[model samples]
Target: MSEPKRKNRENRQHGDRAAALNLFPLPPETEARLVIYADLLHKWQKTINLVAASTLPQLWTRHFADSLQVQAAMPAARIWADLGAGAGFPGLVTAIRLADVPGVEVHLIESDQRKCAFLREVSRETLAPAIVHQGRIEDILPELAAPIEAVSARALAPVPILLGYAENLLDKGAVGLFLKGEHLADELTDSAALGTFARYEFSSIPSVTSVSARLLVVKARAG
Candidate 1:
């Protein structure tokens, strides 16, 4: 393909993604905040490795849309903890989208000080109800004063480890919303073999953004 043709095709693809984002019920203010968030991400991504550089071209569909699906999975969750929230995918996005809702809080857990700073900046700029915790997941998750209603992690760890990381909150009734790619079946098998679930009920929700991706929802079953 010629250079100009390729460039035009790429631009059209980007435009299509931007249009696809409109399918969600995001408020206009939320959309504006996401634009600011995307700008900050691009600026900071230059110095630090926030996200995979290759995915930057499809930031709207690849990251933002993928994250938004998590919110769609559990719309009623007001209190959430996003583990390993690098560049704040679904966590920061959720906070931004739900900025209008009262009593909403999204805690973003990230150990990197620089990334935490970035998260803080976006939260401050967008007025998203996100609290950046610059510490390990194990240390910070256990000490949260507010009861987490949902726990989220994307491309962070395997199913077993994720369950272990959020076991404290999950045992206390918080649902776990994990974003997994094509290896979800294998992960679920491994999770079962490892006895990861003592009381949690696991269900898989298909992701609207990618066919290979899935939203794994873990909720504690009623006794």
Candidate 2:
């Protein structure tokens, strides 16, 4: 590679490292799998538009790290359902991390057929053990047979609406781990008015970009 290109790659790698500084170190095998996942994402991006065009340069920190942090928060959760799992942020990332673990499964629920096709291909190529559920979250949650230990969604919807979509799973004892932005306070206020059956614990995301973002862990119960 030319000097300028090499320097740019090095800078990108450094940025990825800096953004992931707060996450627990992954085992070598898991790290290798994530590398494969990232490469596949880039290759598919040319045709599918898996993520926002602007975020492509910071794929590792912005997308991968943002997703991996959720697994760090809920380490004990083995079975997860990722709603609106577009491009498979936390869901596919979680599956890649837990690929070798016994009984680990991540169900990726995406409504868009094209996105679902991309997700399925990625899962198969990476051997990530993710089951792609191609349908609306409202239609699929009730039909899930496995007992979901935790649920996750990123950049999906407001807390109240997300809770409503995950209501069935939440009522069945699945905890929600959602990624939200600066509007958390407003979301909480709106969710209160909606009489949601879930409670949330908010914490700052260990990210280099957008300090306003947070990790919302929702504990839900039957009302």
Candidate 3:
């Protein structure tokens, strides 16, 4: 009988095949990294549940592609920060894609020490410009002397709670590029109720699944 791990690899390969069929026009380098990242996820998953069990096989489409969608949405971003970056979606992959670009940096923030350690390993292995900050977003925001051009989060939490953690730099001009699902309208309402923001736009997510996927870009009004 074959090892269970080998079976899981076979299943993961099947998932990668499905993701390849999607063809969302990712950069060549990014496409390569996606494959590597998928393998890494499968390996790390044995020790830690970084991603949802059901989505493991389809990591490419469910995670990488979903994150790459932001590329088209914000083509010329320079600096980026992924708040609550669990497993480096829209952050590590984002940085790897932009790795060659001069002066571009992507920061992946995570409060969990283990997650941060894992993120660091991936960053070093991939030579990505992502640095994992092992600290709470809320606690670190007030002290981050430098500012980032954009902020991102996926499956983090309500927009209000999201922005609350991002309040420091967000009060400045940094744009919020949050990955959201279909129920964005409801979250937007709740976010507004939390307090006022500047401007925001919602774009439908481009993915293989017909499900509701959207990117919410929010900006603060100029003072």
Which candidate achieves the best lDDT against the true structure?
1
- Colliding residue pairs in candidate 2: none
Give the top-scoring candidate (TM-score): 1
Per-residue lDDT tens digits of candidate 1, residues 143-218?
8999899999999998888988998898899999999999988887774555556567899998888889899999
Write model 2 residue lDDT over 96-202, tens digit each, in one string.
Answer: 88899899989999999988998888888788989999998988988889999999999999988888888777777788888888887788877454555334333
* Model 3, TM vs. native: 0.84
Error of 2 at 166 (Å): 0.8
By lDDT, the better pick of 1 and 2 is 1
- TM-score order of candidates, top first: 1, 2, 3
- Identify the runs in model 2 with alpha carbons over 4 angstroms from their true place: 1-3, 14-22, 197-209, 221-223
Candidate 1 global lDDT: 0.89
List candidate 3 segments past 4 Å from native.
1-22, 191-194, 197-210
Would you estimate the TM-scores of all the predictions?
0.92, 0.88, 0.84
Tell me how far candidate 3 lies from the true structure as C-alpha RMSD in angstroms. Answer: 3.1
Estimate, for each residue in 1-223, the C-alpha lDDT of model 3 and write its tens digit. 4799899888876767556546566567766666677777788888998998998766777787777766546768878888888988878878877877888788788898878888888887777888778888876666555578788888898777777776655667777877877777787677445444434333444434326867777777665
Question: Per-prediction count of colliding residue pairs?
Answer: 0, 0, 2
**Local distance difference test, each candidate:** 0.89, 0.82, 0.74
